[model samples]
Structures are given as structure tokens and as C-alpha cells.
Target: MKKFIYFIFGGVTFILGTIGIFLPILPTVPFYLASGFFWVRSSDQAYQFLLSNKWYQQYVTEWLVKRKMTVRQRIQILLILFVLLAIPFIAVPNTWMRLVLGCVFIGHCIFFIFFFDKKRTRQKISSENKIFFR
Candidate 1:
């Protein structure tokens, strides 16, 4: 059943997100977002819980309502990518392997940071709004 799947996803996301909080490479926010959505579709309690979470409330709150990302979030994501993806290549022993992995990682980050993140789009909108409103 769909509901069962959501419950399972919610549990997994919560666990992974919780782990992400402690481990820098794991990324807690995305898992939280995933779990929260699962909860949203599956149970009112889960939706309410995610919405109420003090750590996650800000990102999901305005974004869910207005579909925006804050400037701080944008910067944070770039920083995370730099730390997690870029740094790892230095340790890779094989030159070709390093190059390939680095390129893939760069591509992934570029796509996610540029195309996927709503905050960047929101920033553009807000900037345009400022120009028009001013």
C-alpha cells in the first residue's frame, strides 16, 4: 500500500536525517524533507511533527507555503558541497578515478545547486521584485 510505503520512507528518512545531524557528509536536511513529505502524505501527525520541528521549521515552512529558499540556505548548500564533494577527490589515489569522480561530483553539485534548489530561484524572484518595487 502507498500509505505503508510512506510510513517506511518516513522512518528511514528520519533515521538518516538524524544521522546526518551528527555526520557532516550524510546531510540531515534532505532526509528530513523526504521524511516530512512521506509523513505529510501518510499521516497528519507526521506532517505536524515535521512542520513543528524547531530545526527544520524554517526551510520547510516558508518554502512549502511560498516555495522559496533563503540566502543563508543557498550559501550553506554551496559550502556543504565544497566540503563534502570537493575535498574527497584530494584523497583519491588514482588520477583517472579522481578526475572522473570529481567531474561527476561537480556535475551533480552544479545541477543540484543551480537547477534544483528553490532558494536560488527565489532569490532571483526577490531581486526582480525589489527592482520592480523600488
Candidate 2:
């Protein structure tokens, strides 16, 4: 019964994550992470499937393991965040709210640029070289 409930939660979150890929306002990572959490608890097959998924590899696993993102990925996420936040930033009449939104945008930009390191570590470099030379 516990496994069954977890499986259901996993499936639902996975579907939401998939939908999030096309919808800029909806966040993909959190849902995908949640799906992975539930799936791992519920079923090995489901967990392995999530591990093998390209989206999971691109968005979740890389961030989890390396704590970094490719420039393209960062840019893509920032653009989507800007588009989604711009509407409220423009429409809100209160000066305080607008200021808050501006801060949020700036914070996101700073976080993406400074916090998410772009440089590849030596471990990653050596691993890639090994694969390439083989």
C-alpha cells in the first residue's frame, strides 16, 4: 500500500514535470526531483527509467552531481523566468511590488551567473578525456 501510493505520486509528478518542459511558468526541476524521490521509493524500474531519461540527465542529475549548468541551459532558464516575471512586473501598480519583482529578477540573474559555476572541474575533464581517447 505504501509503495502503491508512492508509485501514484511518482507518476503524477512525472507527468507534471513533462508538461512543465513546454510551459515556461511551470518549474520542471522540482517536479522531476519529486517524481524521482517517489519513484525511487516505490519501484526500481520506475527509478531506473527516470535515471535514464534525457530530461532527468540534463536538468536534475547534472545539477545534483556537478552543481553546474551549461551556459545554454542557464540562458534558456533565465529567458523563461524573465518572460514569466515580466508580465507581473509590468502590470502591478504598487511601487513596492514592482520593486520586489525587480529584486527577484536581479536575484535570479545573479544566482544563475555567480552561484551556478560554469567551469568544468578537473575530474570531469579527465573523465571526458578518457571517454574520448577510448
Question: Top lDDT: which candidate number?
Answer: 2
> For every model shown, what is its TM-score relative to the native structure?
0.56, 0.80
Tens-place lDDT digits, model 1, residues 49-124: 8778876765455545455566676667667776665566677677887788778767866765566466677787
Among residues 3 or more apart in sequence or in different chains, the pairs in candidate 1 whose N, CA or C atoms overlap within 3 Å are none
lDDT for each residue of candidate 2 in 7-53, tens digit (9 for 90 to 100): 99999999999898888767789999999999999999999999899
What lDDT would each prediction earn against the true structure?
0.75, 0.85
Q: Which residue pairs in candidate 2 have backbone atoms (N, alpha carbon, C) closer than 3 angstroms, thus clashing? A: none
Report the error of model 2 at residue 62, Å: 2.3
Off by over 4 Å in 1: 58-91, 104-123, 126-134
Error of 2 at 69 (Å): 2.6
